[model samples]
Target: MSDKPLQRALGTTYRAEMSCGDLGKAIRQAATGPTPGEHTLREARVMQASLTAVGKEIEQQQEPTIAQELRTPVAAALADYAQDTGEILNAVNDAYIDHEDDGAWQDGKTVRMSAPLDELIDVLRALSQSPDAYADLRAAHVRQCAVGLAAVPSRAAGPTYTAPGRNCAAGLGYYDGIAEDIPDSQSKQWRSDVLQRLRNSMGTPPAYSTDPAQHITASWQRDAVRQVKVGGSGFLTDDSTRILDIWATARGDDLDARKLDALQEDMGSDACSRAEETTKQLACTREPSKCP
Candidate 1:
């Protein structure tokens, strides 16, 4: 109860076997008051060590998923913002008995961290209390800085939102209309970067969904076209849209193996020699195993 807000939150958190006795026990006993001559500094030290250990372990954990990797840039930006805040808060805490009460800049420092600083702290605070934060936490801290658009007065009054599920990935946002906006939203750009990274490390998954709308690299839209040979074929005639003299079905998700199979079957048995690797790869991405 006596520690600062961040510290209090840290103290109240449960531990399996902290360096201190059970954290809850130490907190309760310390709060009942230390003996008149005895100092309970040991309890404070143990609490600091335990919190540091938790945070350090979380930081050192490897990122094994694309979703986790995507968070790296945002985390780095927030950390830099927090570091800018460090000297100011340290001065206040070391000098003022009631540091949290004061929000003004420190004596020798000109750059006060302000709300940007609070963004990182708030995220850490949330993580400490989150049930899944330690085990499976993947956060996106997107700072969409709006620049040229700000000059358009009509845009100022409305809230700009992405389609649903885009912003649903536990992303925390901080935006500035002019000073902080980065001009381009970079959402698409970031998605491309992240996808390339994922693709290089792990190729398109065998079960990768076939919905182009949901894909980052349009993986589902890639269906290989194979030319079938017909020798004096029957009524299996090629029907192009007549717009182009090309004889092919549409070039979208519908161009799967079933469509190809039916097309060849309708052409009669001698129309196509058995499919060969030289002539064509698999009709779908998974069979090819490496999509363009």
Candidate 2:
């Protein structure tokens, strides 16, 4: 059945999925230059499905090690996709639930500030012991911030006043603190894509200081000019369908557009003024204020 060629093809597909290789862009480049056989996201999924069947066959034959080798990367990629979906849903739901009561007890400054500090300690510990884990953990954490903050819109567009949380600016600052060792090569696109969303999501006044990349100055400007295509590979593209799906679930799967608009309006400002350090804004909007 010529299984050797098929196995090599599947291996190529596996690597593409692992690296998040983009086929459309690859094809465009191929017209003028080298066209490496990179699989698209859809092709990768099909390869993964086929691999799953092959993995089961190998497992049934008691070649468990072979099966594990075949399946682990695919499993890890799926896990990444799942975790991304969950984070997006949570951030969106926070924005979706707009109300005065919702703002109460919603103070997240201490929680936000403290957890990252502790994680930083752990990352430092991992510096010598587990370098790969250190890089991977920090990258995922940074990615989480980009996705989570991007989902929050602004005070004008919808509910920015979630109970107990840092504002978008604070979150970005926290991200910047931990991301120093992380390379711009690894973190830049995810950061840029979500930060770009911030430009419009906040409605007219815009919630943040500037496009977050502006904080990077020269590198930031380069990124803006060089951004290619709509959406991106890896976590950048994960939100495309995930956001709409979770939004539907947030609305109880209701397709009623008017109801959705009403839902956003009803969320109200009830916003927590999370600008604690600047002396620019109060930390708490609700009484019994705990923010600081």
Candidate 3:
């Protein structure tokens, strides 16, 4: 035999025998990239929508399982945060409306609203600084301002009312002016912060072989628990069957009674039979006293 071929064969064997630890380390290093936080705001927005959907699903379930229960608090928190954001937006709108229509403040006449704009600005500033507060307020502020502006008559000159001079127009202008400066980054940051808080509330998914593998494992584990609860001869209860049906529909799996029965029969026959055979072989090979 040629020594070169033998050397090559030996090299291949050596490579195969190398420790999996080094291979794993190399793979991880290669696969590692930017964190989810680094994703674009638009991408984060899409992710937020998906998270919201999952949250809604958990909320709608009549009786939550352990996993659902764990997710519920986080979802509720996010929902509450969203509501707070709306309240803040409404405050901003109210402040703008109150200031905009003031007769004392002239647009270009170096006049200001009668009510204190400073206080509103302070609240906005505070909200921007606090992640929790911002999460509760940002969306609401934007939405309220946008909708309120849309509903109000435009400051254009028309038959019903004459447009004010530049000075008066300037006061009205404050509402639109203040709103335009809200940074996209701030909005994105608030969203990111809320999502992070929600994720923290619900413990991270277990580290498994891969993301998809982890999802599969979780799905199966949930299904298995449902099966046990529902199929137990003595302990089977209404709650158990409801859980099974809910999971089946949520997973998009058919839950026909006949199909479930067929699957149970197949699995029991194959798996139980194989297990029994293995047990019998082990028993037969062992010394009776030692086996006992």
Candidate 4:
């Protein structure tokens, strides 16, 4: 007679109705007999009555399953977006900082390039174009620059650094021509010279020669390890869920099963503890003096 039993019966009927497209017929059939793997009509009625008395119990147990299912994808999506955004912003800030400190760009009056900053500018421009594209590209650029810098032969006087975009004479010649042609009062000859120098030296380094991928990959790998150690707090905070999703997807079934098992175990343990506490409370209510 309780609504819970009736609601459960109606739910069963509704599902049948959806499949069969006849609510009246489904309800009548449900009332008359059991469906496959379910109780008979009489037994179902008894079960439904029992369910009504313990509906809240069932709901409490079921809530975590629903919460976890919903949380997994949502959390992963949020994490991925955050990591991508952070990577782009970090790369841009690094580039700007490095450019500001370049010896050629300093002194405020003279602009000289031990190596041209144009390539760095190009990398920054590429990153500034879109937030999403920047992470991989910035990683690539950083690795490449690091490798190139490392490859500089060791000398007694520290390491000699070669500037990109500074070695070409044609670029300098063009700047000289531009400087001579511009009227002294109207011309920014020094600016023209710098521009010419940049034009001459913009060459793409050999892909095999530079290992930005390795450096970037190594850096991320180390961070990932650290994050895992800190109970995933840093990784979660950084929104690295997408990266994890990618890793999970690539790893196949074993990892997926492991993840699900861990979640279930955690939920199960918490549920048991909660149930025991609730039982104690209920017992105390039944006999106040005996509770002690």
TM-score of each: 0.19, 0.24, 0.20, 0.18
Query: Which residue pairs clash in candidate 2?
Result: 98-267, 106-163, 106-164, 107-164, 108-164, 108-165
Q: What stretches of model 1 exceed 4 Å from their correct place?
A: 1-39, 62-91, 94-123, 126-128, 131-292
List the RMSD of every prediction in angstroms.
23.5, 18.6, 30.4, 32.0
Can you write out model 4's per-residue Cα lDDT over 89-177, one digit (the tens) per residue?
A: 22332433453333122224322112122222222222222222222232333333333333434221211322211111112222122
* CA lDDT, every model vs. true structure: 0.25, 0.29, 0.30, 0.30
Best by TM-score: 2
lDDT per residue (tens digit) for residues 1-292 in model 3: 1123222322333244434343223222221224411223222222233233332332344211113222223222222222222322223335435643231233353222222232223223322344443333322232232232222233322321211111112222222222222345564444355434323333233432244323332433343333423121221112123222333344343235564354334423433333343333323223334443
TM-score ranking of the models: 2, 3, 1, 4
Per-residue lDDT tens digits of candidate 2, residues 1-292?
1234223434443323332223212212221112222334433333333333333333344322222232233332322332222222224334323421121122342100011122222222212122232233323333443344344443323344332122222322222233332334655554444344433222221222453211222222223234433333332222222222333333243245564445433222111111112112111211114544
TM-score of 2: 0.24
Q: How do the residues 51-107 of candidate 1 rate in per-residue lDDT, one tens digit apiece?
A: 333333333332111123213322322233332223222222343233322322343
Per-residue lDDT for 39 in model 3?
29
Candidate 4 regions exceeding 4 Å error are 1-129, 154-217, 224-292
What's the true lDDT of residue 1 in model 4?
Answer: 19
- Candidate with the larger TM-score of 2 and 4: 2
Error of 4 at 63 (Å): 49
- Runs in model 3 deviating more than 4 A are 1-213, 220-250, 253-256, 287-292
